[model samples]
Target: MKEIQAVKSSLNAVFAIKDLGQLHFSLGLEIAKTKKGIHVCQRKYALEILADAGMAGAKPVSTPMVKKNEKLFEQVVMHDVSAYRRIIGRLLYLVNTRPDISFIVKCLSQFVQAPTKQHHQAAQGILRYIKSSPAQGIFDPKDTDIQIKAFSDSDWASCILTRRSITGFCIFLGESLISWKTKKQNTVSRSSFEAEYRALAATCCEVQWVTFLLEDLDISVHHININCFKVP
Candidate 1:
């Protein structure tokens, strides 16, 4: 507390700055400090998005995307391209807190150039899913083991058009999730084993980058765990 105040005072001397006692909200993120830990979310931002999309009263779904058999990339093009692009931009920002929707968002993002009606409907499905848990956010627990662990997986040739594998991974600092990503691989893989190997390789690169980040922050990462699924 004293160190923070000292820094604030030093900054205030040179420039006009008011010391906000504690951070509760900033840049659309709602931060709440609780006895358990710090909980961060964007509930208000999410609600606004629902309202903008005219899905405020839409029924919520359990999942963000339909099953693999349901085609998301139909040839029927949407008329209002701008609207679809806007919603996708918002959802991408929301992915900062909602990792569950990351994979579907990645899939939907690919069709932004020439989005179809199916693509718009798929994007709306995401809105409905967000409506289910608008307040959902990442909780950083107070009690933690202070370790880093990551899990990664891949689906071979998931993209119907390109036949490229999609890679998904999440990194955890102790029990709290800190970072995650879902991306379509640039090249197609010959086998499922090759796809999974690529996923693990991507995960390793992410872990290495995260370790370097921690080192820069002066936080020692004693133990690091990177786990991937086995292809049977």
Candidate 2:
């Protein structure tokens, strides 16, 4: 408080500032304080997405993508491609608080330029899954070690159209998930080993950036562990 007041006093001559007390919402994310830890979710934003998709009362599904290996490129083109794009865009933002949808969203994003009816159905599947638990979010426990760990994997030539590999990774700051990604590789790998190596490289780059960020915040990472899960 004293430090904040001192900074405010110094800045008073230049600019006016108002105390917001605490962070409640920012860029569609909802924040709340709890006994366990800080609760962060986008329940309101999620419901808005469901309503926008016209799936407000749709039946929930046990999983986001039931048929992960289904051929996405062979489907018929969607008449309303903009709707699919909009839903994918919204899902991208929702991934900020819901990492569970990352992989599916990443897959769906590939068809943003020319989405099909099959793509729309897959997106609706995501909405149905969200309907099951709109309030689900990441929980950051207060008490945690200053450790950084990550795991990465890749599916070689997953995309039928481009034959590009898909890579997924998750990073944890202690026991709390801090970052994750599911992205298509820019280049095609000849073999699974090459794809996995590319995934590892991408994960390493992310970890390096995160390490620098934590250092800027004066938080030293004590333990670092990285595991690459190979798919046989």
Candidate 3:
């Protein structure tokens, strides 16, 4: 408490300050304090997304994507490019607290420039999935181990349109996930090993950035371990 007061005093010397007390909501993220930890979610934001997509009454689904009928660069064109862009832009922000949809969102993002009916339908599927558990989010345990760890993987030629692989990784601060992404490999890879290596390279860059951010906040990690895994 003394440290916080000292920092507040210093800030007040140069600029105005306001203590909002414990955080509950900011920029669409809802924060709830609990005995176990801090629970973060965007329930309201997710509902807005569903309504915007005209799926508020839609039935919920268990998974974000349907494996058997997934859309992959379908040729059927959607004339309303702006609509597609708007929905995807919303989903990208929604991923702030919903990493489970990250991969499917990444896949749908690739077609924003030239979205098809199938692409839009696939996006709606994601909204239906969101309806299943709108309050689901990350739980950051208080006073837990602060170790840093990361795991990365790549799917060999996951994108049928470009034959490019999808690389994904998640970084954890102890038991809490802090950073993650699923993106298409910038360059084509010759084999699975090469693809996996590229994914690790991307993960390294993210870890470096996160480390620097933690240092800025004066939170230092003594050790970091990286693990590579096969994408199932």
Candidate 4:
């Protein structure tokens, strides 16, 4: 704590700063410190989103998205494109603390330029899901072990319009999830194996970056488990 105080004191000496005492809320994220860990969420921000969409009392859904169907591919453009784009932008920010919604947000982001009625509906479904658990967020345990693990997966040709693959992965520090991403691959994969390989390669790069980061922080990573599905 003294080291942190000294750094803060030095910064204060050089630049004007106000001590916030403790982090409870910042940039839409709400932090709660506990004996188990530090929990972070955006319940208030989520509520605001729901209120903006006039879905404050909408029925909650178990899943953020529905099964892929023909309706989703229809090019019937939405009348108000800006509203859809604004919702998507807010949801993108919400993904910072909601990993469960990461893939869906990535999927919806593709339609921002020309969102359709179906796309707008899908975005609203995500809001309904958010209503289910507005307080859901990542937890960093206080007694977490110094171990790194990652899991990677890919869906071959999941994009109906482009036939491109989507890569998703999550990295864990002990039992706490620290980093995750859901991204569409730039090129199309010929086979599932190729898709899986790309996802695994992306995950490996993230692991390497994370290991270097830990080393910089003087935290030695003795065990790193990078797990992926066996390619057939």
Q: Pick the candidate with the highest lDDT.
A: 4
Q: Which digits, one per residue and each the tens of the lDDT, describe model 1 over residues 106-221? A: 88898899998888888999999999999999999999987899999999998888899999899999998988988998889999999999999999999999999999989998
Better of 2 and 3 by lDDT: 2
Please state the error at residue 193 of candidate 1 in Å.
Answer: 0.9
Rate residue 50 of model 1 by lDDT: 100
lDDT at 149 for candidate 4? 91
Alpha-carbon local distance difference test for all models: 0.91, 0.91, 0.90, 0.93
By TM-score, rank the candidates, best first: 4, 1, 2, 3
| Every candidate's CA RMSD | 1.2, 1.6, 2.1, 1.2
lDDT of 2 by residue, 1-232 (tens): 9998899888887888777788999888899987778889999999999999899989999899987666577667777798899999999999998999999898889789888888888999999999999999989998889999999999999888788999999999998999999999999999999999999999999999999999999999998899999658
Estimate candidate 4's alpha-carbon lDDT, on a 0 to 1 scale. Answer: 0.93
lDDT of 4 at 70: 62
Clashing pairs in 2: none
Task: Specify the poorest-scoring 10-residue window by lDDT in model 1.
Answer: 65-74
| Candidate with the larger TM-score of 3 and 4 | 4
Itemize residue pairs with steric clashes in candidate 3: none
lDDT of 4 by residue, 1-232 (tens): 9999999999999999999898999999999999888999999999999999999999999999877756777888887899899999999999999999999888889889988998999999999999999999989999978999999999999898899999999999998898999999999999999999999999999999999999999999879999997765
